[model samples]
Target: MAENGTGVVEFVLMGFQLQAAQGMGLFIVFLACYVITLGGNLGMILLIQSNPRLHTPMYFFLGHLSFLDSCYSSVIVPQLLETLGTHKMIITFERCATQFFFFTLYASTECFLLAVMAYDRYMAVCNPLLYTMAMTPRMCLGLVATAYAGAMVNSVVRTGCTFSFSFCKSNHIDFFFCDLPSLLKLACSETSLREQVIFLLAFLVITTSTSVILVSYLFIIRAILKIRTASGKAKTFSTCASHMTAVALFFGTLVFIYLKGNMGKSLWEDKIVSVFYTVVIPMLNPIIYSMRNKEVKEALKKVLRRMKVS
Candidate 1:
């Protein structure tokens, strides 16, 4: 028998490892962030839905991205809020596994969605003549469906592998949520193969999606340079600005957290960085899109005015 217990019934989420007072402070801050994440993502979705002008493929993908961000934040942030309160954070095996599965699903889906958006932008900017015909509503729906399917497959594989192992080693999870990386660390069985698989999956998701985005940008930039007028080029570039900013923020944080090095040594640091993707980025998306996208801004204004009038 160990000092803690013989068998682990539930995993104790060592979320943030802050004092009670500090936890309370963070709770307030994260609560505000969660509210913003929900509001921003849902607002963007409704804004896109209501405005007939936003019926284009760009807004179509943007609306889906916002929905993913909202769901992603929802999966992690509410549990995080619970941990940030006065009580010790404990999640049952089943609930933790549920969290891990859905979070991965949403995260992976967002990655693929971003790549698809980049390709859409590339075609729109570089091959505007064929944009409407090629990116038809049917094709757009197929792409979104494909993204969800990929995420689901990956999530099922990961969660099944992760929970298959016994956790007699320790029940203390070092991160806020039951992420694959953190959970894998606690496994008593052979994790070398599982870790390799995870690393490969990470590489495939990050590299493949990032490659698409990069190549799409290359063609887009080339097309812009060929535009003779500076104003026309600026207008062309402006179309991609929000997505580029979003990609930079999302993938930048993702690369920093996963690829930098040694997650164990910087688990605490990684937790902080994790907050950006899980909480902050969702909130930032609508603001970024609304600010950089003139159409979205106008749509938002019109929506607000109608609400006020009512």
Candidate 2:
């Protein structure tokens, strides 16, 4: 069976339509989500950058996380809004491929970054005396750089393998965006190579991140147990809670989307899961971290005071 390059030049995404009546309502809802996502992530970035109090290694990592979320949301939400508005869900092949590439890149980068954050918490909690030495400026920079590099490599490999496959049949992508699994089903050629590539990449990235976070927390828990005072334990747990929540939410949806059996699932199923990571999580990240963190609150206040004075 050779590849089928038939009449279709582009794909029309059927984005979650229960009925015509609900389209307007859904559009309004997602539009609000996009606005909040943009505002929250950008606000956190500005807050971290402008505040002298937040110039530490932790805040430095956080600022980058916010930036990543901003880019991540930008890649997905605008197109989603357009789809909602015009009801013209058509995306060019090149544009769809580019969307998947960057979306995968930033998402993978965030996974690694979250692992780094777990390690940061572990050191800060477990080895407070040596925290400065362990997590130096150079080390932080190196960790962040590694995250971006690893994600880029993964994106290149995945996108290359996907695009290499021949698209012969119906060009209409069933989902709202170009996702690996959904796109794979549309390939007219044998997807043995692509399947193997996706499995390997998913296993490597997910396993490594999960292991790092688990090990780091083990050390963190051990250190917390060694603390004699109740107040001290309470304080340490408080510091880690927000990050743990974020990690759990992120990896949970990720695992469900990618790790499920490749059964007869529709593209709409994938799109719903994609929404969690693409739209909802980005909006929630800053709210999760900043609203709960003392440092972020203090930094915001300081920044506000400075602005008022200036």
TM-score for each candidate, following the candidate numbering: 0.95, 0.93
Candidate 1's C-alpha runs over 4 A off are: 1-7
lDDT of each: 0.88, 0.85
Model 1 vs. true fold: TM: 0.95
Q: Per-residue lDDT tens digits of candidate 1, residues 70-105?
A: 998999999999888756588988898899899889
Estimate the lDDT of model 2. Answer: 0.85
For residues 138-191, what per-residue lDDT tens digits would candidate 2 score against the true structure?
A: 999999999999999998998888888777666766677777766777777888
| Candidate 1 RMSD to the correct structure | 2.1
The alpha-carbon deviation from the true structure for residue 148 of candidate 1, after best TM-score superposition, in angstroms, is 0.7
